[model samples]
Target: MIKIGDFNKLKVKRKADFGYFLDGKTNNTKDDILLHNRLLGKNNINIGDEVKAFIFKDSEDRIAATLIEPKAKVGEIAMLKVVAHTKIGSFIDIGLPKDILVPFKARTYDLEKGEKYPFYIYVDKSNRLAATTDIDTYLTTDHEYNVGDTVTGVVYGFQTNNSAMIVVNNKYAGVILHNEYFTELKPGQELNLKVIKIYEDGKLGLSPRQNRKEELDVLESSIMSYLEGNDGFMRFNDKSTPEEIYTVFNSSKKNFKRALGVLMKKNLIIQNSEGTYLK
Candidate 1:
């Protein structure tokens, strides 16, 4: 059967002035789908020649076939660029003659032209192809990724508490929870992230940076900021209680010591029995 919103290899049944009619493989007379003249991509099609084409509804809401492969097909996800918009919806460039609509109701935020978003493609209630950015329901936790694996994603949505929700590899569900990274993330931003943990529910926890040297650099910077905020004197040291270290550093005692050690090695700070102070 020829399924709309998918690719179908249909035999050319006959030729007409407008274009060739493709056999829908169904007995119904109305089952013949059209491969319109404008959509016939340079191929000299003959009757009985099977043409592999993407099937979709044309502007007139009639079934049609095109040689143009869309950015995504039914039940698949992809990053699609916004091309135009109307009061009701935003049109996406899916590499088709007719842009696919991401209905206003399906959008999670205001759509902007030229911006690309990870979208889920599906046939809407009207059986017409559409794209949607509100895709959390389409994401699944059944993934092959493991901790420490490098992955890329686009920021699609945000949690109420400022966590960034990401669409990983345009399919999997991933997130960088609040305060996971120091930088504030915005929608449509693409990021290269590292998988930090896989939850019991299979959701992925991600981090923006991972190298030990890079982590140390960030920690050192945070320590300097803390010292600057406290008049260049921090009343804590390696000998301080873990609770005291955590209260001041917002990190584990071990990490605090590492940052302090780096600062000491560089002679950027002086540690005495009284406390640690900037040199």
Candidate 2:
């Protein structure tokens, strides 16, 4: 059965001067498949050679193929080696007769032949497979992601706002804000993170470390040290905001509130609704 918007395995039934004809018998409708020589090259495609091709509309609205290799598919991420560079784009040989085009706009840096680069494969408006370097714009899943769900990702680059570009699970690329990136990060660096938000678009928001119980303990100790350093009386309400808490403790306001709540409950500190003072 031939399916639209997908590749189908067809048997080469006959060879012609212009192309090879494939047979399709499904739903009692006989459809002729054309494997154009221009798209397939001069290679002799014999009868019964199972070829994988994507169905597309021809000039006459007939279902023809664009001759996609068995291995290549839409929404796939691959490490393809660059074969040639044109004025408009670079061509990658992803086991296809016609190398896939990675448009200049989709490229992050200059591509040279013999070098392998990771890219996401997608079908453009023209119904042709194209490669994109911007992997962040495409994400399509939503699982049970919590605030501290451990995740793994590769650092793509950085944003002007100091967010780190990361490809998580090769499913989607996302940003780990500079404030969220507590540790050092470099381009192409792979690290573990925690899920901050699972966006509606299926893109993930990430954080560097999971501020678990132990982490909170360390942060509480730091706050105590800061108070001790200030002669046991610290006026920090004016200075402690969400940003400051993140910068100093690598935690959120809720976490800080919880930590301070614990301290206050233990009578280690005193609060009078104005601010917290060391006791």
Candidate 3:
């Protein structure tokens, strides 16, 4: 049987001027899929040869088969680039002649062209090949992952609280709370995340922070750099607002104070109500 949006082993039944027709096991040629000559590469095909072809509908909505493997197949996840946008939906290049549509209803937000984001490929109810940014719905929580395991993921979106919704390893659902990260994360950005907790359903709670000592070191360095850049004086101090500290050092107010304390203990800086200065 020829299944659209999936691979099928079809037997070459007849030859045509443009290509060969692979039998769809139905009575007539109407269901026969066209396996174009160009798709066969340098290998010659003959009648009675069985080809493992990926089946899909072309731009014309006609059943087509290809020997070339797409970047991702149905029921899989991949980082696909948005190629075009339309009122109906956006299109993504799937390493095929006809790009796959990502219906607007399936998108969490408006996808910009040229930006690559992870998507889940699936056959819609209409039996059409489509991709979606609603990857959470497609990803499962069942995995062998454990807490403290480092995993890779792509930032797909942000919640109202600014937590990142991530597709871990392109298969599992994960999230990094806003407080767990000190930097701004954009959609489609790839990150190495540390698993802080595994939910009851197996969804991972992740963090992008490093060890306390390392983070302190980095924070102190950033403070020193800011001071040096400002002619050996810094405008922010322990009394600075949390927002100010975050904006300047991408850190929490408590961490900022700790870093400042470390710097002051080393006699590298002096802070007064006005601000801090190199000592």
Query: Who wins the lDDT comparison?
Result: 3
Per-residue lDDT of candidate 2, residues 152-182 (tens digit): 8777668888788877766665678876756
Per-prediction TM-score, please?
Answer: 0.78, 0.49, 0.94
Model 1 per-residue lDDT tens digits across residues 194-243: 99999999999998865767777877998889889999998788788876
Instruction: Identify the leading candidate in terms of TM-score.
Output: 3
Q: How would you encode candidate 3's per-residue C-alpha lDDT over 1-279 as one tens digit per residue?
A: 567888899899999999999998899878889988888866688999998899998888888999998899999989999999998999999988899999989898778899999998999887789998877788889899888889998999998999999998888899999889878888899998889999888889998888789999999999999999999998899999999898878999999999999999999999999899998
Task: Quantify how close model 1 is to the true structure by its C-alpha RMSD in Å.
Answer: 5.2
Query: TM-score: which is higher, 2 or 3?
Result: 3
Q: Which runs in model 2 stand beyond 4 Å of their true positions?
A: 1-6, 15-21, 24-71, 77-84, 108-118, 123-128, 182-189, 196-203, 208-279
TM value for model 3? 0.94
RMSD of each: 5.2, 9.9, 1.6
Better of 1 and 3 by lDDT: 3
lDDT of 2 at 87: 89
Off by over 4 Å in 3: none
